[model samples]
Target: MIRLFITRHGQTEWNLEKRFQGSKDSLLTELGEKQAGMLRDRLASQNFDLIYSSHLQRAYRTAEIIKDNREIKIIKDKALSEMKLGDWEGLKYDDVIEKYSKEYDLFWNKPHLFETTSGEGYSELKKRVIGSLKRIIRENDEKNILIVTHTIVIKQIMAYFEKRPLEKLWDLPYIHPTSLSLIEIDDEKTNVKLHGDISHLENNVKEIC
Candidate 1:
């Protein structure tokens, strides 16, 4: 069996401002850094064979903090990064709601029909993420791995493994920043032992689910 501990990157300045990050980058807020520290504390006793992180700074930084000065080389993969939001990368939530209401609605309400004028489609995002996951798992045998990525990436992965319909993408729970989820993979099957865990935060941050 292989134990995969998947987590979202910590909060960022854009997150606080309720802006879309997409492929854009931002610094972690103080709370975001602390959240990563808390995650390190939570998993201090656990042993991991390897750590994989998205190419984004937020995810890489979170992984570094979790390693806590320990000498572990984190593998960076673009496939693990957040879904590119294109023109919406830096837009505020309220603005996107007002201007791109139809697209945003499809994103959350009917993901199968979701596509962006400038961003990546949900189908492409899911394919890349799932493909990356499969390759990672295939390369290792009976190892514990930690993957630090983004909200959309993690949610799509969980939804895929859980055998949910693509049209019901919102059926997946809100993926809290720095939240952890465990997926157990074996020769026969895969199991989602936990999904979107943020109890360690203890109100240090506010997020849906």
Candidate 2:
């Protein structure tokens, strides 16, 4: 059996500002670092054979915190990065809503039909993320793997495992920063043990954009 522990990076400055990070970069907030520490403490007893993270500083830093001086190697892969938001990369939520109203609506309401002006669409993002996951699974069987990525990336991955349609991408139960999800795969069977779990954060859990 293979155990997959997946999570999103801690909250970032842009997250607090309600700005779109997408492929752009941002530093983690103080609370974000605290969240990572909490997650590190939460999984201190667990062992990971391999750790994969997006090249983004926020995600990579979170992975490092979770590693906590462990000898585990963290492989930074662009395939694990967040969906490219193109023109909306650094724009605030309200600004994006006002500037790109139609595209924003499609993104939240109908992801399958949404198209990016200069970035990747939902299908493109899913294809790359799922492809990376499949490659990882194939390369490392019967191993505990850790993947630290972004909100949209994590959500798309979970949705794929759940066999959910793209149209229902933003259903409910938001993927909070540092939220951990576990999946077990044995032979051809896949089981999701946790999905968007924030029990580690306890009362410190705060919603981010």
Among the numbered candidates, top lDDT falls to 2
- lDDT for each candidate structure: 0.88, 0.93
C-alpha RMSD for every candidate: 1.3, 0.9
Q: List the residue pairs that clash in candidate 1.
A: none
For model 1, how does the per-residue alpha-carbon lDDT over 49-114 read when each residue is reduced to its tens digit? Answer: 899999999999999999887766699999999999998889999999999999989888888888
Lowest summed lDDT across 10 adjacent residues in model 2 is found at 200-209
Q: Candidate 1: where are CA atoms >4 Å away?
A: none
Cα distance off (Å), candidate 2, residue 11: 0.6
TM-score of 1: 0.96
Q: What tens-digit string does per-residue lDDT give for candidate 2 at 1-209?
A: 99999999998999999999999999999889989999999999999999999999999999999999989999999999999999999999999999999999999999888987698899899899999999999998989999999999998999989999999999877899999899999999999999989898968556655
Alpha-carbon runs more than 4 Å astray in model 2: none
Minimum summed lDDT over a 10-residue window in model 1 is located at 200-209
